[model samples]
Target: MVAKMAACTGSKDGQDSILEPLCFPEQPASSTSAPSLQGPSVELLVCLFCPESVPLRQKDVLLKHLLLDHKLVIGDVRLIADLPKYMLYWRGRFLEQPVSDFCSVIKTNSTGPLEKQEDYFLLCDVLPEDRILRERLQQKRLEEVLEQQQLERDDSSFHRLCMFCSEEFTGNRSSLLNHMAREHSFSIGLPDNIVYCKQFLDTLQDKLDNLQCLYCEKTFRDKTTLKDHMRKKAHRRINASNREYDRFYVINYLELGKTWEEVQSEDDRELADDEDDDWSDWWAHPVSAVCLFCDHQSETMEQIYSHMKETHGFDLHQLRTELNLRFYQQVKLVNFIRRQIHQSRCYGCQETFECRDDVLRHLVAEGHVMTLPDASTWNQPQYYFPTYENDALLCTLSDSDEGENGETSHVEDVPVIAEDVSELRALKQSSVLNQLLKSRGCSS
Candidate 1:
């Protein structure tokens, strides 16, 4: 469906047209051809090998080191039939995950323990192009062997002349010629040692040039040999070693001093009340010289020791031993004061109450009427309630009886009942007095 959409397009006339025909009916389903993909020139072909030199029994130790140290991913693996008992790391971690995605099973450069080197080298020797290169090299060597045999059998006079110098030579003419051409400047016929050796070395050096290093034209024979040299500590030391050491030491020293300066600056800020303008606050002492716990200061000596014992539960000897402090006599003292304050109670009943409501309840429950202290008769504490009536008073008495009988009142809470109870109680009280007058034959 995607292919069809990709292939279909619109022409200028606004009609749909086939931009490209999708591959379908003609193509075989069983085609094993690899899909074309754009990739890097040097593909990262990973390989991992765990040597027996390590103390650990598991190969995961070495695989973990590869990921942690070298930053490589192990893509896929095929078990070596001869050594199927060994453990393998499928990816970045220890895993038994299926690994069919990789081009091949690969082992990385893990070579040590003298016996492992040959096997490791053999594995490296088997690169994807290695077989073809080896065959070509073998054929070339065979041709050289045949040519050498023919030269040995030849009795021709041309054998007496050097191949390189063209000078007369009797025995082993080819060797003498190679010696002259490779080592000494003997002939200018084709190429001399000075010109060709310099050029050849230059070409070899160019082939081995790395991003950070240049191979020495005078030292190594070829690029591979130069690479071997590059792996050595001496060669690295010769190339940008100063820069590496300087970079590492500079980073370490800077990190060390950075923490020191940070701590010092934090202490300075804390002492100065975290304010840049308050420099004097760093040195200023508190107004009171008395210590909070012992109530002692720098002023008193003998009384300070006594205060330490009574207030802080610390004798001079105990304080000195446990707290690692100097003489308590060196300390000063301030007064430690303690006192109590009494609150007022109800005047008539002498009952402790925080507010007016409790005093009013006391008076009402006792069947006593309340009036101001200046009134002719002072029976109870008085409160101003303009809405109070006899009918409200009787209703309150009925609600109180219901409460004493363990019934839930229609009123929800204290605030609502408190607001309406005073008026209801007053109304109930007046109604009772009127009924008493009617029963006594008095006028309404």
Candidate 2:
């Protein structure tokens, strides 16, 4: 009965009755059309305030845009919180990154699971502003340090502190020496402290190298040059008898309870007094005529002489010295003028003039006096010798005719040649003056 029933059930569809499967095997999906869990197709950095979006390529460029273009300050909590919402595409998806993760990566300085581009961008957004501020502060600090160092160097160069007394001094060695002598009674060559004394002496020698000529007030590089200048200019011969006259001594006006401010005010008053003098006008309108004695500009030789005598306090000795110096200077200037005369040029200005008269006019108008002494005076015999009655030496002019007649005729207050050294010796025995003259091969 069961076989008949099965046959009948199959017979209804028996002509094409094949056993049909209840379930079919599942077909694999096409790889090309499959959806991926990795997120979106394009990566972009979108602006929060505008519709502008930049390709997520470089972190720095994006950060610069945010800071400069959008005027955003990085590291703000609100901005960082809102950053993911503005990011149109992140990790190939729109707003796929969590705000916490994004902020964490932005704050980090190291590379990790996050893409390097995103990591750097985050770092740039958070740290650059602070970094720049710190760098600027460091640069300012460095500059301040350098300025302080320079100030210290300048102070050391201009001023020195006494190692023993800790007193600061701003003048030369002679001033320091005088201070030591006066304040401490310290003699430089004491046998008790010979080594220390020698060291101090060496320092003084070094300082003396930078001294000025006491007579001419001209600065020299070293003592040798100063000595040479004294010899060549015959300053020693002129001031021979007055040994202490030209010596440089530092006077401590401050010791008398006078302040530096008071001294400065007194100096200013003196300068004001000088400005009220006639020479101030002379200086204001500089003339071509320079003084032979001191390079002082004057309209005439008489004016020059007056200036030297009154302003410089020149004695007969100083006047004779200046006269001698002037003679040589005049000779040089005359030669220069002669050479330039043919070219119709003013020797002082070195500019071409219309004629010799024009040059002369320019020279005279500009106070360029180049007057030579009378030819008669050039050949006259002159002498400078100290008199026992006065500290200053007397200049005498000897009559040439009287000299030829074997009789010495003395002209009062004029430079003359002395025939008798015995007469000078009879007047005074100045060992210092004798040694000075002897060094210059002169018999005093």
Candidate 3:
């Protein structure tokens, strides 16, 4: 257990009166309790307004005193880089000057009928001094973390055994961590993603020795019982609400006021919102492409190609080879033919017809399937976008960059998750997954 410190009731001023003492422990101690995992050690937190008040263990207790007695409320305590040092600096400053000099005061019941009024001080980074203090603390912390990261990366004397099996690992801490995850299915996270490897491992080892569940934090009778409970209940993961593990992750140190989970969750929320977005304005339409020779519409490019070859004796693919048409060139030719047919005109002989059917009859009767007006007549840039918005033919147009077997060569799309036809991967065999599957009636 962490050794509790003796409270300093000794006043800094000339006052002779003694006060009650408060005590706490410095971390990296031998403890079986939850506080041992709270990576950093914060010991003496002095009251801001109380000169004779002893140092407090928890910052919340000191904040309570300030809020209740001094009417001082600190805004966004989580945003403070270093709370102990921050409070100490403010404590000294409060002694020299009034809090109103650096704080914004709100008088309660300003416009109310009540005669009595009370004031509350908001101590945020709104003041220039506080903003500078927070920024300086953040810079100092970043430098220290970077230095520590270099030391950890270079560390090689690490030696530990697997948490589940008795396999001993040397050279780097990741070896042991990876072994525990692979063999025991206990993954805290990726090795490269975290810092303070030694202390984090120690905290987990302490919990295991104490026969505690990592998730629920419940004490068990024995190691066997604890392991069984964790496996059966799917409690192999660390507690989500436990702020103690914050220091172990490098992401917690990267952002000013956000953790890795918070950053990751923001991305997840955006994707979820995108999935939930309203697409009610969209209406379903036929997936049909129009024929180049006539007004005949087919659901697919293949069907249209077949109909043109049979009815008009026009093999567009053959003509494409004869003219040595590139991908965009083929697109423009098809679009030009379609436009001419729609306007009741023959594109090959440049003859106007009474209707679309008359133009198709004229092209076939005059044997103008292989004939054209000119290269410049059909190879315009305006045919880049298909004339018909629902044209499936444009999607299947072959390109030199699309390999020998281009988009015209169809391949069915398959899902990433393969069906239960063979053996399952190692992840699917995990106890946690098995428990979840069993709960959902997917496993017997």
Candidate 4:
């Protein structure tokens, strides 16, 4: 079949045609079943109360005029489908009855001490007629959008020359839409996802012909200036806030009684709401801290220490008291013991066994629990790390400055043991570890 004008308009004679209006060959509309975006619709929103007000193609302009001048506010004007028609219906009804009958009056804006407070009218779905009108318009808009979608989907007479280049496309609306998107970087959306293809293009072409920027709507002196402004400003698309163009996209009409934006955000809203309902109290449970030497595990650090002291005869409290271990020293000592036991070696004598049970038996039978290797051997810099990933025993290690009455001690994140390393004599004589280091020398 020969291509006809739908998306783009030109008498394509196999050459680069100028962007101009072309005729669409007549096709059966099935009048009772389909609605078209052709002919005059209510494109301009007129003030509902004003008799001689300027016609506003922009909804925002019309909305502001109504609020400031007429003291009327239309609720969620963006969400309202067929905004002009909705306003027109109310304009006619305002003449028939008192405006206060269908609207809620809010008295505000006191200009002076002598002047009376002005009353502002809120026209929303609180009234039954307003609710029914919104629902009816939404239902009508959805039906028309759906029918237009089917027409474009089955349309075969799509022919047009590129607005930016000399490329020509014939048959399948997507071919022209895709080419424009791929070559010129102009995309309204996927061809199948849009309705009213002809009207959408015509609206853009009219703006280009008038030398107006599609995004900013500023009029330029010439087509060259307009082209430069659009390209430089990255304005290759229509104005998003202009609700007049909402009828072209199928997404805006996909849902009833809700905006497309509201529907899309439901998942995010649900996740946020779920986070507020936390069950931290019910889900709380104690994670066990493992013993330093053996496989003995307890729920708390205190319980683990008690079990190790009673069962394995490994008194860590006695060692800390004798050595006057600081916060980091205790951390290193627990890690050192843990590393040695994991390698199936006794921390006391440094003797390797086939398994952990064999090492535990050797340590117990040989009475090497209190007999530790030289301080120089185990007190290397590498022992600062926790050998176990979530070493629970390290959590109970207190600072040397902590009082015997269970008072908390001041300590920084980094260990302060090396802070007084300059005073070698005092460190060597005061702590049992330094004394052991001197006595044992290099022997383990």
Candidate 5:
């Protein structure tokens, strides 16, 4: 409970009026409700914002006023650090002046200087500041009241069923016993066990009747162990009839109106959706890596290793060996393509086949179409031979060799056209994978 204080209006005199009066409810003087803000009884010097003649009592009230009103910016008001040098009196008189001492007494109870405490403490050194003290006490009382209100809100009394199924401790006991016997099929006989015969018999009878599962017939000393049996699969399979008996979940029919089936169905649906997202990251890569595979730049061996392991069936070791071999192979093929493009000549159209073809099969398969001039002279639209494009002898002998020796001439004629150029272009434009490689800054 925070104490309430009236606004401070300035005094007519040139001095600052620091304190304000407060109104509090009349209570027994013995009540321990005032905020404990007693300072040392010693007459220590305090800083004042008025002439040196201003009374010390006024300074104490001013500190309390500043703390309650400007607590956010100025914390504990006792030690004057960056406080304003003007004072407004209760009668609304305003005076401005530098405090003569520029220092205040260090209260005995406080561990450090007043400035360090959070803005809640309204410190005032003057012993006679009764009006401000009363307000602080009232505020403390208010806080206690608020705390008690919060505790009242937290206490909830809903359906309170006894752990033993024999008796339902609802608002009515007779109806509970009748419902237990008729609907639950509970027995009436009590048991004979232990020294406290009547008390133990009553307790045992309640447990045996209330226990939804008779197959286990296990009477736990505590409710927690009995609940574990209901949840475990072994108990569920044995006491299948007890599936409908949930003590914690049962709600009063007069208050809630919710059925057990509705709550169970909602819980099962959420469990199924959570299972699919566990595998979402297995096949999908980050969107940024898509461009790297689209263009066939020579991929680093490490990059290819990761790509093959993730996208293809290959793992790290096999991918590493394959990638290293592929890199050098592509490099050699690109160089060969450059040389063939420079040396090749065309015999059919009398034009260089440097980077051209009558009609390339793979190129057409990739959506490129070209009309072949003559099938006999062109030899089934062969790949553009960079070397044979300018070599007339190589082009002339290429077709004739196939006719003369068939398989032998066909093998020998292969060198007349360089196929490595196409392979080089394919490797250059189709394979580089850009992945965030872990920096190898540390060694094992």
Candidate 6:
């Protein structure tokens, strides 16, 4: 018996439409051909869109064909409903089934109403295998975007801002510290709350593209030009008066060769030594003086200057320019130490005492001596005089009456005198007898 029903269709109003019947031919009976060993063959879905009625065994392949060839989406409800016109047969059944019957069957199997695109696929049972994979990929992309946003937020949170000028900085702690110290004249010992700002550091980097002098605030095209300017202007000597403050930074530079604890131990040892012990010996020591640029050391300033010039192509001025920041800080510290040292007070402790002696006592008791060891020697003088032992010249000190008295005084081993010192006293004193005779109004 042949059973016929209207083909499924969809109207402009999104309602089902009845259409003419689509034919399905029955399998021919096997007479002369041998009976197949297999049971009833698996049914194939056929596309009516092709004149040949192309057969696809798998639903996924049919869906891909519909999408790729027919330009139809599998899961779309209206499209799926309208698809019966293009579906000659499904599972060996003619496409002449009632639209309501197909809808009813799908509604009976699925949990929800057939409203969404995925729901239509679920009803039709042609959902792709990689559909789940696509969803997981989309979900993974969303998670990655969220994680990147969170990291950006956290990074912004760590950025530091200047308290005084309300400027922003993007650099790390060291760069921020250098900026604060240089631009704002901000002390190194800032309050813990002060922070670096992202904006300021970025701006500072842009500004620094042109080499600028930190001391004179002059901008230069390159380092060579800056060096020339520094040499001609004598800008390196700008920190000469501030060497006391520079001394601390120099000490800090030395400390970089070793750990803080090690430097502290060395300082302790030095402090424990006797007062009469020549502190000049420490000046010749390796740890005491190190090159600002390369950490090279020597006994005297002249040797260090020579080393810097020969090895690093840096003269004294160039070396000083390189170490300008250290010199700047040193000047400030020296001034502070001088002020506090003479005031009979401890700057770190902020305690006042009656006399300098009492202040030293307090400093020793509170361990401030270790902290500001330079303060103890603030009263001492620092002198630099170059001596040449090889060159010598001799001159005699004589009374005017020496020739008349047939007596001559000769002196040997005197250094050559570059300038006249005829009015000055001789190195060797005249005899007291001659001086007494001269003073007593008697000729020697």
On TM-score, the leading prediction is: 3
What TM-score do all the candidates reach, one by one?
Answer: 0.13, 0.15, 0.51, 0.44, 0.12, 0.16
lDDT of 3 at 69: 88
lDDT for every model?
Answer: 0.31, 0.39, 0.70, 0.72, 0.32, 0.39
Per-residue lDDT of model 6, residues 1-444, tens digit only: 111111111123422122111222122222232222222225455652453333333556676765567444434322231133324433223246433343322223355555532322122433342234334444543343334333332342345665335577663344455556566554433222222223323434443445664346578988778657755775522232332222122222332223233566675555665666766655441322233223245546556657756764445334223433232233333334434543445645656655555655666577664353333333222101101111010011121222446654243422233333433345223767778887999876
Per-residue CA lDDT of model 3 for 1-444, tens digit only, reads 222221121223323111111122223233221211135564577778885343434678778888988999998888777777888899999999999999999899888766677899999988889988988887777656655655665467888877677688888676677777767778888776677788888888889889998899999999899989999999998986799888887788776767777777785545546555787866875566555654466767778889888977888777776776666777888767655654566778677655666666777788887688788888776666555454566666653322365544332331133223323455567669687888898963
* lDDT tens per residue, model 2, 407-427: 644555334553435645765
Query: lDDT for model 1, on a 0 to 1 scale?
Result: 0.31
Best-to-worst ranking by TM-score: 3, 4, 6, 2, 1, 5
Candidate 1 worst ten-residue window by lDDT: 333-342
Per-candidate clash tally? 25, 18, 0, 0, 36, 13
Worst lDDT run of 10 residues, candidate 5, spans 289-298
Model 6 ranges off by over 4 Å? 1-158, 164-166, 174-293, 301-306, 309-444
Residue pair clashes in candidate 4 = none
Report the C-alpha lDDT of model 1 over 16-130, residue by residue, as the tens digit. 2221111211212232333222121232223343332233323355545655654433322221211111222223222343232322343444366655432111221244443
RMSD of each: 45.5, 44.5, 25.4, 24.4, 36.9, 39.7
Name the TM-score of candidate 4. Answer: 0.44
Name the top lDDT candidate: 4
The segments of candidate 4 whose C-alpha lies over 4 angstroms from its true place after superposition are 1-32, 39-71, 109-115, 182-186, 205-245, 256-263, 266-444
Better of 4 and 5 by TM-score: 4
lDDT, candidate 6, residue 36? 20
lDDT of 2 at 194: 22
In model 5, the runs with Cα more than 4 Å from the true position are: 1-127, 130-140, 143-444
- Candidate 5 lDDT (Cα, 0 to 1): 0.32
Error of 4 at 172 (Å): 3.0
lDDT of 3: 0.70
lDDT of 4 at 156: 77
Q: What is the lDDT of residue 100 in candidate 1?
A: 28
